[model samples]
Target: MPGPVSNDQFFARVGELLEENKKAGHGSVFFTQKRLTPSNVQNAEDKDPLWDVNLPGPFAVLIRATNGKSKENRDDKIKVSTVVQPESSEEFFKQYADVCKAGMQALKPKDRSKRKKKKAKKRKGPVDGEKKP
Candidate 1:
Protein backbone atom coordinates (compact mmCIF):
# COMPACT_ATOMS: atom_id res chain seq x y z
CA MET A 1 0.00 0.00 0.00
CA PRO A 2 1.11 3.56 -0.60
CA GLY A 3 1.57 6.07 2.18
CA PRO A 4 -1.02 8.76 2.65
CA VAL A 5 -0.38 12.24 1.33
CA SER A 6 -0.04 14.80 4.13
CA ASN A 7 -1.97 18.03 4.14
CA ASP A 8 1.20 20.04 4.10
CA GLN A 9 2.48 18.23 1.03
CA PHE A 10 -0.76 18.70 -0.83
CA PHE A 11 -1.00 22.40 -0.03
CA ALA A 12 2.64 22.97 -0.85
CA ARG A 13 2.29 21.39 -4.26
CA VAL A 14 -0.74 23.51 -5.02
CA GLY A 15 1.01 26.70 -3.97
CA GLU A 16 4.07 25.93 -6.04
CA LEU A 17 2.06 25.27 -9.17
CA LEU A 18 -0.09 28.35 -8.72
CA GLU A 19 2.94 30.59 -8.24
CA GLU A 20 4.62 29.18 -11.31
CA ASN A 21 1.62 29.92 -13.49
CA LYS A 22 1.07 33.37 -12.02
CA LYS A 23 4.65 34.41 -12.66
CA ALA A 24 4.42 33.19 -16.25
CA GLY A 25 1.99 36.05 -16.97
CA HIS A 26 -0.89 33.61 -16.74
CA GLY A 27 -3.02 36.17 -14.90
CA SER A 28 -3.97 35.58 -11.25
CA VAL A 29 -4.54 32.38 -9.32
CA PHE A 30 -5.64 31.54 -5.79
CA PHE A 31 -5.68 28.40 -3.66
CA THR A 32 -7.88 27.58 -0.70
CA GLN A 33 -8.70 24.56 1.48
CA LYS A 34 -12.06 23.71 3.01
CA ARG A 35 -13.01 21.22 5.69
CA LEU A 36 -16.02 19.06 4.96
CA THR A 37 -18.21 17.63 7.70
CA PRO A 38 -19.62 14.19 7.19
CA SER A 39 -23.29 13.50 7.72
CA ASN A 40 -24.25 11.92 11.02
CA VAL A 41 -25.92 8.56 11.17
CA GLN A 42 -28.87 7.86 13.48
CA ASN A 43 -29.59 4.55 15.17
CA ALA A 44 -32.97 2.84 15.22
CA GLU A 45 -33.15 3.07 19.04
CA ASP A 46 -33.13 6.88 18.85
CA LYS A 47 -30.14 7.09 21.15
CA ASP A 48 -27.20 9.49 20.97
CA PRO A 49 -24.57 8.62 18.38
CA LEU A 50 -21.44 6.87 19.73
CA TRP A 51 -18.91 8.40 17.38
CA ASP A 52 -18.45 11.65 15.48
CA VAL A 53 -17.60 11.56 11.79
CA ASN A 54 -15.97 14.29 9.81
CA LEU A 55 -14.25 14.61 6.45
CA PRO A 56 -10.76 15.98 5.90
CA GLY A 57 -10.14 19.29 4.28
CA PRO A 58 -10.45 19.50 0.52
CA PHE A 59 -8.20 21.85 -1.41
CA ALA A 60 -9.34 24.07 -4.26
CA VAL A 61 -7.28 25.98 -6.80
CA LEU A 62 -8.66 28.76 -8.93
CA ILE A 63 -7.01 30.29 -11.98
CA ARG A 64 -8.20 33.43 -13.68
CA ALA A 65 -6.99 35.21 -16.83
CA THR A 66 -8.07 38.52 -18.25
CA ASN A 67 -7.42 40.66 -21.29
CA GLY A 68 -8.38 44.10 -22.53
CA LYS A 69 -6.93 47.46 -23.53
CA SER A 70 -6.13 48.01 -19.86
CA LYS A 71 -6.98 46.71 -16.40
CA GLU A 72 -10.00 49.01 -16.18
CA ASN A 73 -11.36 47.94 -19.51
CA ARG A 74 -14.16 45.30 -19.31
CA ASP A 75 -14.94 44.85 -22.95
CA ASP A 76 -13.76 41.23 -22.93
CA LYS A 77 -13.04 38.70 -20.19
CA ILE A 78 -13.30 34.94 -19.82
CA LYS A 79 -12.97 32.62 -16.82
CA VAL A 80 -12.72 28.95 -15.94
CA SER A 81 -13.17 27.30 -12.55
CA THR A 82 -12.86 23.65 -11.52
CA VAL A 83 -13.19 21.50 -8.39
CA VAL A 84 -11.44 18.20 -7.72
CA GLN A 85 -12.50 15.58 -5.18
CA PRO A 86 -10.14 12.74 -4.39
CA GLU A 87 -10.64 9.98 -1.89
CA SER A 88 -6.93 9.55 -1.26
CA SER A 89 -3.77 11.61 -1.42
CA GLU A 90 -2.58 10.17 -4.69
CA GLU A 91 -5.96 10.61 -6.29
CA PHE A 92 -6.19 14.13 -4.97
CA PHE A 93 -2.86 15.12 -6.44
CA LYS A 94 -3.74 13.57 -9.75
CA GLN A 95 -7.07 15.31 -9.88
CA TYR A 96 -5.55 18.59 -8.83
CA ALA A 97 -3.04 18.42 -11.66
CA ASP A 98 -5.77 17.65 -14.17
CA VAL A 99 -7.93 20.51 -12.99
CA CYS A 100 -5.04 22.93 -13.12
CA LYS A 101 -4.24 21.96 -16.68
CA ALA A 102 -7.86 22.32 -17.73
CA GLY A 103 -8.12 25.68 -16.01
CA MET A 104 -5.03 27.00 -17.74
CA GLN A 105 -6.41 26.05 -21.11
CA ALA A 106 -9.76 27.67 -20.42
CA LEU A 107 -8.24 31.02 -19.48
CA LYS A 108 -9.16 33.88 -21.78
CA PRO A 109 -6.85 36.77 -20.99
CA LYS A 110 -8.85 39.38 -22.86
CA ASP A 111 -11.60 39.40 -20.26
CA ARG A 112 -9.77 38.28 -17.13
CA SER A 113 -9.39 41.54 -15.16
CA LYS A 114 -12.07 43.76 -16.58
CA ARG A 115 -14.36 44.79 -13.79
CA LYS A 116 -16.52 47.85 -13.26
CA LYS A 117 -15.15 50.24 -10.69
CA LYS A 118 -17.31 51.54 -7.88
CA LYS A 119 -18.22 55.25 -8.04
CA ALA A 120 -16.23 57.38 -5.64
CA LYS A 121 -18.05 59.44 -2.99
CA LYS A 122 -17.65 63.21 -3.22
CA ARG A 123 -16.26 65.03 -0.18
CA LYS A 124 -18.43 67.74 1.37
CA GLY A 125 -15.52 70.19 1.54
CA PRO A 126 -11.74 70.30 1.18
CA VAL A 127 -10.00 69.53 4.49
CA ASP A 128 -6.47 70.55 3.46
CA GLY A 129 -5.11 73.57 1.55
CA GLU A 130 -8.60 74.90 0.64
CA LYS A 131 -10.86 76.54 3.26
CA LYS A 132 -14.11 74.91 4.36
CA PRO A 133 -17.30 76.81 3.54
Candidate 2:
Protein backbone atom coordinates (compact mmCIF):
# COMPACT_ATOMS: atom_id res chain seq x y z
CA MET A 1 0.00 0.00 0.00
CA PRO A 2 1.15 3.52 -0.80
CA GLY A 3 1.80 6.05 1.95
CA PRO A 4 -0.33 9.10 2.57
CA VAL A 5 0.32 12.09 0.40
CA SER A 6 1.94 15.28 1.63
CA ASN A 7 -0.10 18.42 2.21
CA ASP A 8 1.74 20.31 -0.54
CA GLN A 9 1.02 17.65 -3.11
CA PHE A 10 -2.68 17.59 -2.22
CA PHE A 11 -3.04 21.37 -2.55
CA ALA A 12 -1.17 21.34 -5.82
CA ARG A 13 -3.63 18.85 -7.22
CA VAL A 14 -6.41 21.16 -6.10
CA GLY A 15 -4.97 23.97 -8.20
CA GLU A 16 -4.69 21.70 -11.22
CA LEU A 17 -8.31 20.60 -10.85
CA LEU A 18 -9.48 24.21 -10.69
CA GLU A 19 -7.61 24.97 -13.87
CA GLU A 20 -9.09 21.92 -15.52
CA ASN A 21 -12.58 23.15 -14.69
CA LYS A 22 -11.85 26.54 -16.23
CA LYS A 23 -10.50 24.98 -19.39
CA ALA A 24 -13.49 22.67 -19.64
CA GLY A 25 -15.93 25.59 -19.54
CA HIS A 26 -17.23 24.87 -16.08
CA GLY A 27 -18.59 27.98 -14.39
CA SER A 28 -18.87 26.51 -10.94
CA VAL A 29 -17.70 23.59 -8.86
CA PHE A 30 -18.83 21.84 -5.70
CA PHE A 31 -16.73 21.17 -2.63
CA THR A 32 -17.68 18.19 -0.53
CA GLN A 33 -16.16 16.15 2.27
CA LYS A 34 -16.23 12.39 2.63
CA ARG A 35 -15.00 10.02 5.27
CA LEU A 36 -12.31 7.67 4.11
CA THR A 37 -13.36 4.05 4.12
CA PRO A 38 -12.32 0.64 2.93
CA SER A 39 -15.06 0.68 0.32
CA ASN A 40 -13.74 3.95 -1.08
CA VAL A 41 -10.05 3.15 -0.94
CA GLN A 42 -8.33 5.52 -3.41
CA ASN A 43 -4.66 5.17 -2.62
CA ALA A 44 -3.84 3.24 -5.70
CA GLU A 45 -1.39 4.49 -8.30
CA ASP A 46 -3.51 2.92 -11.04
CA LYS A 47 -6.72 4.71 -10.12
CA ASP A 48 -5.66 8.34 -9.69
CA PRO A 49 -2.25 9.90 -9.70
CA LEU A 50 -3.15 12.45 -7.06
CA TRP A 51 -4.85 9.79 -4.96
CA ASP A 52 -1.91 7.42 -5.13
CA VAL A 53 -1.15 8.04 -1.51
CA ASN A 54 -3.41 7.32 1.44
CA LEU A 55 -4.66 10.45 3.16
CA PRO A 56 -3.91 11.02 6.85
CA GLY A 57 -7.18 12.39 8.15
CA PRO A 58 -10.49 10.54 8.53
CA PHE A 59 -12.29 13.12 6.40
CA ALA A 60 -11.27 14.07 2.90
CA VAL A 61 -12.58 16.95 0.85
CA LEU A 62 -13.25 16.59 -2.85
CA ILE A 63 -13.89 19.50 -5.14
CA ARG A 64 -15.84 18.42 -8.21
CA ALA A 65 -15.79 20.52 -11.33
CA THR A 66 -18.66 18.78 -13.07
CA ASN A 67 -21.98 17.43 -11.90
CA GLY A 68 -22.00 13.64 -12.18
CA LYS A 69 -25.71 13.12 -12.84
CA SER A 70 -25.14 11.97 -16.45
CA LYS A 71 -22.96 9.11 -17.51
CA GLU A 72 -20.86 11.26 -19.79
CA ASN A 73 -20.57 13.96 -17.16
CA ARG A 74 -19.65 11.38 -14.60
CA ASP A 75 -16.91 10.07 -16.80
CA ASP A 76 -15.67 13.61 -17.38
CA LYS A 77 -15.79 14.65 -13.75
CA ILE A 78 -12.60 16.18 -12.39
CA LYS A 79 -12.05 16.18 -8.65
CA VAL A 80 -9.19 16.90 -6.29
CA SER A 81 -9.08 16.10 -2.63
CA THR A 82 -7.19 16.58 0.60
CA VAL A 83 -7.43 15.38 4.16
CA VAL A 84 -8.61 17.62 6.98
CA GLN A 85 -7.80 17.31 10.67
CA PRO A 86 -9.09 19.89 13.08
CA GLU A 87 -8.23 20.46 16.70
CA SER A 88 -11.72 19.73 17.90
CA SER A 89 -15.24 18.93 16.68
CA GLU A 90 -16.35 22.46 17.48
CA GLU A 91 -13.42 23.85 15.54
CA PHE A 92 -14.25 21.69 12.58
CA PHE A 93 -17.85 22.85 12.51
CA LYS A 94 -16.85 26.47 12.86
CA GLN A 95 -14.35 26.25 10.05
CA TYR A 96 -16.78 24.34 7.90
CA ALA A 97 -19.39 27.04 8.32
CA ASP A 98 -16.87 29.73 7.44
CA VAL A 99 -15.74 27.89 4.36
CA CYS A 100 -19.34 27.38 3.22
CA LYS A 101 -20.11 31.04 3.71
CA ALA A 102 -17.07 32.04 1.70
CA GLY A 103 -17.90 29.61 -1.05
CA MET A 104 -21.49 30.89 -1.21
CA GLN A 105 -20.25 34.43 -1.47
CA ALA A 106 -17.83 33.48 -4.21
CA LEU A 107 -20.56 31.71 -6.19
CA LYS A 108 -22.79 34.77 -6.21
CA PRO A 109 -22.48 36.97 -9.29
CA LYS A 110 -20.41 40.03 -8.62
CA ASP A 111 -22.78 42.31 -10.48
CA ARG A 112 -26.33 41.18 -10.95
CA SER A 113 -27.63 41.54 -14.49
CA LYS A 114 -29.75 44.59 -15.05
CA ARG A 115 -33.50 44.06 -15.00
CA LYS A 116 -35.12 43.76 -18.41
CA LYS A 117 -36.27 47.07 -19.81
CA LYS A 118 -39.97 47.70 -19.25
CA LYS A 119 -42.05 48.39 -22.33
CA ALA A 120 -43.32 51.94 -22.51
CA LYS A 121 -47.10 52.18 -21.90
CA LYS A 122 -49.13 53.75 -24.70
CA ARG A 123 -50.85 57.06 -23.78
CA LYS A 124 -54.23 57.68 -25.44
CA GLY A 125 -54.86 61.16 -24.05
CA PRO A 126 -54.58 63.40 -20.98
CA VAL A 127 -56.29 62.58 -17.67
CA ASP A 128 -60.03 61.91 -17.99
CA GLY A 129 -60.93 65.02 -15.94
CA GLU A 130 -58.07 67.22 -17.17
CA LYS A 131 -58.31 69.33 -20.32
CA LYS A 132 -56.00 68.51 -23.22
CA PRO A 133 -53.72 71.31 -24.50
Candidate 3:
Protein backbone atom coordinates (compact mmCIF):
# COMPACT_ATOMS: atom_id res chain seq x y z
CA MET A 1 0.00 0.00 0.00
CA PRO A 2 0.98 3.65 -0.27
CA GLY A 3 0.74 6.12 2.62
CA PRO A 4 -1.17 9.16 3.69
CA VAL A 5 -0.22 12.09 1.48
CA SER A 6 0.10 14.85 4.09
CA ASN A 7 0.52 15.25 7.84
CA ASP A 8 -3.00 16.62 7.90
CA GLN A 9 -4.31 13.43 6.44
CA PHE A 10 -2.11 11.39 8.69
CA PHE A 11 -3.16 13.30 11.75
CA ALA A 12 -6.73 12.99 10.74
CA ARG A 13 -6.27 9.27 11.15
CA VAL A 14 -4.41 9.70 14.41
CA GLY A 15 -7.14 11.92 15.77
CA GLU A 16 -9.49 9.03 15.45
CA LEU A 17 -7.37 7.13 17.94
CA LEU A 18 -7.78 9.79 20.61
CA GLU A 19 -11.36 8.69 20.94
CA GLU A 20 -10.01 5.29 22.07
CA ASN A 21 -11.47 3.95 18.88
CA LYS A 22 -8.76 3.48 16.29
CA LYS A 23 -5.60 1.53 15.45
CA ALA A 24 -7.50 -1.76 15.72
CA GLY A 25 -7.19 -1.71 19.51
CA HIS A 26 -6.37 0.33 22.60
CA GLY A 27 -3.08 1.46 21.19
CA SER A 28 -1.74 3.81 18.56
CA VAL A 29 -1.52 4.16 14.77
CA PHE A 30 1.95 4.73 13.51
CA PHE A 31 3.03 5.86 10.05
CA THR A 32 6.35 4.70 8.76
CA GLN A 33 7.68 5.69 5.39
CA LYS A 34 8.43 2.66 3.29
CA ARG A 35 12.03 1.59 3.17
CA LEU A 36 13.95 2.82 0.16
CA THR A 37 17.16 1.62 -1.36
CA PRO A 38 19.17 2.53 -4.46
CA SER A 39 17.29 -0.03 -6.53
CA ASN A 40 13.79 0.85 -5.28
CA VAL A 41 14.36 4.56 -5.77
CA GLN A 42 13.48 4.35 -9.45
CA ASN A 43 9.89 3.34 -8.91
CA ALA A 44 9.32 5.41 -5.78
CA GLU A 45 10.71 8.50 -7.45
CA ASP A 46 8.24 8.21 -10.26
CA LYS A 47 5.55 9.83 -8.13
CA ASP A 48 7.75 12.66 -6.86
CA PRO A 49 11.46 12.49 -7.39
CA LEU A 50 12.63 15.11 -4.91
CA TRP A 51 10.24 13.80 -2.29
CA ASP A 52 11.16 10.17 -2.66
CA VAL A 53 14.86 10.97 -2.74
CA ASN A 54 15.07 13.48 0.07
CA LEU A 55 11.91 13.26 2.14
CA PRO A 56 11.67 9.46 2.22
CA GLY A 57 8.29 9.35 3.83
CA PRO A 58 5.94 7.06 5.68
CA PHE A 59 4.00 4.56 3.63
CA ALA A 60 2.64 2.16 6.19
CA VAL A 61 0.63 2.07 9.39
CA LEU A 62 1.54 0.15 12.56
CA ILE A 63 -1.37 -0.60 14.83
CA ARG A 64 -0.39 -1.72 18.30
CA ALA A 65 -2.42 -2.29 21.41
CA THR A 66 -1.55 -0.07 24.31
CA ASN A 67 -3.32 -0.42 27.69
CA GLY A 68 -6.53 -2.31 27.36
CA LYS A 69 -8.83 -4.08 29.86
CA SER A 70 -6.34 -3.35 32.64
CA LYS A 71 -3.90 -0.73 33.70
CA GLU A 72 -1.01 -2.92 34.78
CA ASN A 73 -1.14 -5.01 31.65
CA ARG A 74 -0.11 -2.16 29.43
CA ASP A 75 2.58 -4.30 27.88
CA ASP A 76 0.13 -6.72 26.33
CA LYS A 77 -0.46 -5.44 22.83
CA ILE A 78 -1.59 -6.46 19.36
CA LYS A 79 0.22 -5.09 16.36
CA VAL A 80 -1.23 -4.79 12.89
CA SER A 81 0.46 -3.23 9.91
CA THR A 82 -1.00 -1.81 6.70
CA VAL A 83 0.19 0.05 3.66
CA VAL A 84 -1.16 3.29 2.33
CA GLN A 85 -1.58 4.03 -1.33
CA PRO A 86 -3.18 6.96 -3.09
CA GLU A 87 -5.96 4.76 -4.29
CA SER A 88 -6.55 2.91 -1.05
CA SER A 89 -5.81 5.34 1.75
CA GLU A 90 -9.40 5.84 2.75
CA GLU A 91 -10.28 2.24 2.44
CA PHE A 92 -7.23 1.25 4.43
CA PHE A 93 -8.13 3.65 7.21
CA LYS A 94 -11.66 2.32 7.37
CA GLN A 95 -10.38 -1.22 7.48
CA TYR A 96 -7.81 -0.30 10.13
CA ALA A 97 -10.38 1.42 12.31
CA ASP A 98 -12.61 -1.60 12.14
CA VAL A 99 -9.69 -3.86 12.83
CA CYS A 100 -8.65 -1.90 15.88
CA LYS A 101 -12.14 -1.95 17.30
CA ALA A 102 -12.59 -5.63 16.66
CA GLY A 103 -9.18 -6.78 17.82
CA MET A 104 -9.25 -4.72 20.98
CA GLN A 105 -12.16 -6.77 22.24
CA ALA A 106 -10.24 -10.02 22.21
CA LEU A 107 -7.01 -8.53 23.47
CA LYS A 108 -5.76 -10.32 26.56
CA PRO A 109 -3.93 -8.53 29.30
CA LYS A 110 -0.22 -9.20 29.15
CA ASP A 111 1.36 -11.20 31.91
CA ARG A 112 3.94 -8.82 33.26
CA SER A 113 5.76 -11.67 34.98
CA LYS A 114 6.42 -13.46 31.74
CA ARG A 115 7.89 -10.38 30.14
CA LYS A 116 10.31 -9.95 33.00
CA LYS A 117 13.69 -11.53 32.43
CA LYS A 118 14.84 -13.99 35.08
CA LYS A 119 18.02 -12.80 36.72
CA ALA A 120 20.68 -15.49 36.99
CA LYS A 121 21.28 -16.89 40.48
CA LYS A 122 24.47 -15.65 42.08
CA ARG A 123 27.27 -18.19 42.74
CA LYS A 124 27.03 -19.53 46.26
CA GLY A 125 30.76 -19.41 46.91
CA PRO A 126 33.19 -18.19 44.19
CA VAL A 127 33.47 -18.20 40.42
CA ASP A 128 36.33 -20.80 40.69
CA GLY A 129 34.04 -23.05 42.78
CA GLU A 130 36.43 -22.98 45.78
CA LYS A 131 35.06 -24.67 48.93
CA LYS A 132 34.38 -22.28 51.79
CA PRO A 133 32.34 -22.26 54.99
> Evaluated with TM-score, which candidate comes out highest?
2
- Tens-digit per-residue lDDT, 1-133, candidate 3: 3432453444444444444543444444343444324445456555676655464554444333222334565454322233355455677667656644554454566667643433222444364366543
Which is the better candidate, 1 or 2, if ranked by lDDT?
2
Please give the ranking of all candidate structures by TM-score, highest first, separated by commas.
2, 3, 1
lDDT of 1 by residue, 1-133 (tens): 2232444454455555555555666555555444333334333344435333332345333222222224664443322223333445466666667656654654565653334222121242334326634
Taking all chains together, the TM-score of candidate 3 against the true structure is 0.26
Point out where model 2 deviates above 4 Å.
1-5, 34-70, 87-133
Cα error of candidate 1 at position 25, Å: 1.1
Candidate 3: which stretches are off by over 4 Å? Answer: 1-38, 42-82, 106-133
Candidate 2 lDDT by residue in tens digits, 1-133 = 2344444554454445555555666555565655545556555767678773556654543322223335665665555444544434455456545544544443556543443222121132334336554
Candidate with better TM-score, 2 vs 3: 2
Candidate 1 Cα deviation (angstroms), residue 6 = 1.0
Q: After aligning candidate 2 to the native by TM-score, how far in Å is the CA of 90 from where it should be?
A: 12
TM-score of each: 0.24, 0.34, 0.26
